[model samples]
Target chain A: MLARTSLRELRHRPLRTALALTGVAVATAMLVDMLMLGGGIQRSFEELLRSRGYELRLSPRGTLPFDTEATISGYAELRDALASVPEVAGVAPVLAYSISVETTDSPDEPQTSLRALALGIDPREQGLLRLLEGELPGSGEVLLDRRTIEETPLSVGDTVDLRVAGGLDVAARSGRARVSGIAEFVFSAREDRPIALPLEDLQSFSEMGDVVSFAMVRLTDGSEPDRVRADITARIDRVEVTTLTGIVTEANERLSYFRQLALILGSVSLVVTALLVGTIMAVSISERLGTIAALRAIGIPRMRILRALTAESLALCALAGLAGLGLGVVVAGVLEDILSDFPGLPQAVDFFVMRPSTLLLAYLLLLLVGAGAGLVPAWRATGLEVASLLHAEEP
Target chain B: MSPAGPARDTRGVIVVATDVTRDYRMSGSIVRALRGVSLSIPEGDFLAITGPSGSGKSTLLHLLGGVDVPTAGNVRFLDRDLGSMSVEARASLRLREVGLVFQRFHLLPMLTALENVELPLAAVGLGPGERRARAEERLVRVDLGDRLDHRPGELSGGQRQRVAIARALANDPAIVLADEPTGELDRSTSRSVLDLFRRLNDDGTTIVVATHDLELAEGARRRLEVVDGRVEA
Candidate 1:
């Protein structure tokens, strides 16, 4: 009966109830958006790393994969030592550098220089790139990323002139290779398209003999990447060995700022929800003090009254939480669309992804906030002196 | 000093008050609402307490109904000391034994007349079906069976008072305490309420009314007039 009374009261005061629900829903939506952003980027990066068959990456110490001008000096010795391990299936050496590509077919037209990420790999290794047309690149051949083909006049069977960007203490190097195939590579940074060539030829043309940026380690079936990474780190010096999990952990650590900002904003939203709900409940309870006092005089227990009031708040919050979930999805979808066009983020990576567990936790948080917001008013209602309040005039 | 009253029946005494003095602190001044006043109400008695405004008639009724405790002295209902009981315990006692009707008809504005009557039954832990049946019977007795679904705002002043009276009797309480139950009704409506009370008293339910109306007071089997916080002959 108390619950029914409470529901009836809420139904009668539609404007106040709607205001409280809107506050709760807006706060819940903010929290849901934060949860989506926190997990989406990490999951997308992990998927990108796992797409290649490589289990471990070896890069120069203090350098990331494809870091500009970063090269390991003893690549041959490192490769031989890694291949000697029992669990090692194959090792693909890579030399990645930023270079300008110009079309030789249209030299008379003002030469257009487009910057591209050039990757040096072994043709026989069947490495990271997924070929869509023609064969893999040979000694004097190149494989252009599909994006590169679409962005520029470059295509399969075209010979392009490439010039390596000059760095400190190293002069600019130039070379030409036939575009033998068009393919897709997951690691292509959003700002630059990728083009692949033979590692030996790239080394000879760039005058960086026996120097490579990183090595991709393909493990045998049933081999654990952690154990292999640890062994390689023990065998090699001045080198860093990492698995996909390690890279993701590092990336998430760097992105902790986003999580912190979300926490602050989400906390503010919760406080706003609590204050809004609490104020409305306080006003409603004050208005009904006479009725509550009458109920008390007629022998209704304080706890039962409190339960009815809290149940009303919980009902409002539950409705708001469901609405917030839909609102959050729409907001996340907008964020995803906006971020997909952002530079340096791969097209395959999602900016906001909703996981079931994350959404469940968000709902639970809203429930707690709702109950907590109602507690102050419920306590006040219970503490009213039945005799005094009954005698007191209605407010 | 005790006021002269009709012959008392010792075996049927249901409420007793001894030297009750209720004081209030208002704006730094001491106001004694009930100063050394005492009374006894017997079972099945229709008693009227008549007084002008601020004569402490309502305060005495509150004390007798276990809604408030006196600042000094003791009040007992059915041989149980109300002053010695906790607030919750007094509430429980009221739920089981005492019914109250307020002057203002403090029915929940959102609930129907039937639901308002069922509220007290729910407090006593009755199941929904049983509460509904009992509430319907009480509303019928009050001639409000057809108006069971109407809210307090939709009912006339007299009808609202009848609903309040019906709600007071929902638990079959041992005693019903009404404070000016007909104060807001017209003459005909007030007479009807008085007739209903007389009929309930004849049916063996103890009824106490606090009012300033001479007609309502004259109908009681015993009457006490209060002035300046003291009862007079």
Candidate 2:
């Protein structure tokens, strides 16, 4: 009955209740979003890193894999030596270079040329490219990402001429290859048109002898990554062996801005939620102080009255938090779409990932904020002088 | 003066105030409201404490009702010291033993007449069905049975006062302490409320009324007049 009464009192003034709920709901939604963003980038990066089952990466010494333009020499020797180590399932080397590809147009039109990023890798053993629409490209053919097909006139069956671009060999090393298939390049940004061809074709054409950017190591099933990394590191000189965990940690450090933003914004939203809830409760209790004193005079226990007040605040914050959770998921989707479009990001990484821990943390914070906000007014309401307030009605 | 104490017959006395003095510190100055004023209320007695405004009639009533402790001296409800009781225990005492009515009819505007009457009954932990029936019966006793569902804001002055009186009687207390029960009513309504008090006393309920209205005071079986916080009974 007391709860019923408390609920009725909140409903007694509908506009005030609605306004309070709106403010609290907005704050709650923001906090929920912040919670999702706090460690979401790191979590999703780790997921992407593990998706291919490539447990270790060998990058140029003092660099992340393919993080820079530095290349490793004698890729075939390095690959063979790493494959001989115990628990090493296979090793695939990768190299990236830019090329100007010109397509034959109609006789009435000039040739169309565009600069495209191309990868050099063994067709059978690489972890980076996945066949989405067509078969993997052979030596004389190249694979293009879906975006390149959509954004450019290139498709799976077009023969295009290529020359080394964006470095010392602007048009120096020239060749031609057919577009054999369209594939998914996991590291390509949304706007990047990338291609993949045989490692020897790219190495000989670009005139960078047996050179590759990095190598990815896929361990045998049930092999520990740390043990494999130690063996590979000892076996391969002039190469830095990076486990998936290490890369994720290093990327997370670089992305600390996201977590810091989440913490600051989440803290601000919590403070706002606390203030909105606290002010609403204080005003509601203030409006009913006379009735509270009268109830106290009529033998209603102070604890009971305070409990009713607490119920109001608890319900307000909890309901608002729930509503905000639903709203936050939608907002996070929109924000994620916007962020994933950022240039140079891994295609498989999500900007805002939702986890059960974030949801639980958000809700728990709201409950605590509600309890804290409600306590002040409840104490004030119960502390009023019953005799003075009650007997003010005497004359 | 004989120290202004109640009679020695403990069995007949339900409340006794021995030289009770109540003081208020207003704006950093002590203003005495009751100066060693003592009184006793016997079982089934309809006693009126009458005084003009600021003469401490309400203060005395507050002390007697166990709502406030005296500054100097003591008040006992059924031989238990009110000043010594815990706040919760004192509230429990009020719930099971004392009923209080106010002049302004301090009914929660959000509650209907029946709920207003049911407040004290609910305080005593009465079940829903029983408290509702009891509240209806109390409202009928005050002639406001038809207005049970009307909120206090929707009711007239007389009806609101009747609801308050019904609320005071809901717990079936041993004593009903009315602080100016008829003070806000018109002549006819005051007569009716005073008649209700007389009927309650006749039905063997102890009644205490603090009021300035002479007609209401004179209607009580015994009257104590106060001037400058001293009783001139």
Candidate 3:
């Protein structure tokens, strides 16, 4: 009976009920978005690391995975030695260098000179760059990342002039190569305009032979990356060897600040939800004081009355939770689109992703908040002086 | 405290008040709503309490119904001291043995006439089918059988008061306490309500009414007047 009565009352007051529901829904949406953003980017980054089947990364000691100007000297000997290992399936060396490229049609124009990252990789290696158009770069050809091609009006079969930027202990070099393909690199940073060419060609042009920035190692099936990393560390000196899992774990530790921000924002949303529902319920209970007093005089227990009031709040929260889930999905999608274009965020990393369990937990939390908010008004109703109120004039 | 379960055996007296005084602390002053007033209502008796405005007649009615406790004295319902009982205990007793009707009808505005009448029955943990049957019977007794589905807003003042009266009788209490039940109706409608009360009294349900209407007071078997919170001969 109490449940039925509460539903009837809520139905009769559509405008007030709608306002309260909208407040709860908006709060729920905010909470859902915060949960989604807490781990979305980290998950995307981990997936990118594993896409190329590379289990181990070899970089300069005391440097990050792709730090600029950090190169490994005597890379030819290291590559041969790593290939000789029984657990190693393949070893691919990469030279990362920034260069200035100019369109051939506008040779001397200042606007035609674009800064780009030049990646030197062996063309014979498989499972590296994903080709979208044309073929992979051969001996005298280069592959430009999609963004670089879009920015410069360059397409397959076009020739462009390149000038390497001077780095520590390395002189500047320049060359021209035919554009052989357009591709997307999974590891490219948001602002990086990348182009790939044959490793030997880039090494000869840049006068940096037998040196590379990093080596991506793919191990044989059933090989443990940790054991391989330990073996490599024991064999090699002046180099840091890390498995893909280790890199991802380190990245997640660094992204703990995002989780903390999400916590703070999520807490704020819950507080807002409580206040919104509480205020509305308080006002509604005040307006119905006379009826409540009448019920008390007619011998209704205070606990029963409280249960009815809480039932009303639960109904409203359940509806709001469903609406908020849909709204959160839309909001998260829009945020993902907007943040994908951020200047330095990786293209493969999404800023918002939905996990069903997290969303379900958020909905349950909102329902609990709704029940808690109803308590203030329920207490007030139970405290009414039935005898005095029944005789008093209506206010 | 002894277990006072609904007080079925009251030794022929359903309600008794001894030197009851009720004080109200309003702003800073202590305004005594009832002072040194005493009364006894026997089973199956039709009693009327008449007084002018602010005369504390409603306060005495509330005391008789066990809805309020006296500040300086004691009220006994079915030989059990109400002053010593917990609020929940008094509520339980009221649910089993007392009915209350207010001047403003007090019917839930959102519920139908039948649903409003079923409120008390539901409070007493009656089954849905039994509550519906009993509520319907009481509404029929109040001559609201044709208006079962009408909300309070759609009903006339007299009809709304009839619904309130039906709700008061939902639990089949030993006594019904009404405070100016006809104050909001016209003279004709008021007489019709009084006739319904007289009929219920004839059927052996004890009736206690507090009113300023002389006609209502004259129709009761026993009448008392109140002035300055004191009952007079």
Per-residue C-alpha lDDT of model 1 across residues A334-395, encoded as one tens digit per residue: 98887777777667778677889989988998889888888789888778777778778421
lDDT of every predicted structure (CA atoms):
0.84, 0.84, 0.86
lDDT of 3 by residue, B116-166 (tens): 988888887777898899999999999999999999999999999999999
Any residue pairs clashing in model 2, and if so which?
none
Order the candidate numbers by DockQ, best to worst: 3, 2, 1
Using Cα atoms, each model's DockQ against the true complex is: 0.58, 0.59, 0.61
In model 2, the runs with Cα more than 4 Å from the true position are: A106-112, A166-171, A391-395, B1-10
Q: What is the C-alpha RMSD of each candidate to the true structure, in Å?
A: 5.1, 4.3, 3.9
Ranked by TM-score, top first: 2, 1, 3
lDDT of 2 by residue, A1-395 (tens): 56667878778888988888888888888999999998888888888778888888998888888689999998878877886887888888888888877775557546777778888988889888789887788988888788767766777788888876445644466788898998988777776778899988888778889999998888889998988888777777689999999988899999999999999999999999889989999998887777788778878888888888888888888888888888888999999988888878887888888888888889999889987898788988798888877655344
Best by TM-score: 2
Model 3 TM-score on a 0 to 1 scale: 0.88
If scored against the real structure, what TM-score would every candidate get?
Answer: 0.89, 0.93, 0.88
Task: Return the lDDT, model 2, position A172.
Answer: 67
Per-residue alpha-carbon lDDT of model 3 for A1-395, expressed as tens digits?
76678878888899999988898899999999998888777887888778889899889987756765879989889988898788999888888777788777665543477888788897776445789999989988999998887777788998888887677976777788899999988777678888899887777777877788888899999999999999998888778999999988998998878888888998998899889888888888887888888888888899998999888888888898899888988999988887777776568777787888879988999999989998888887778788777766431
| TM-score for candidate 2 (chain B) | 0.93
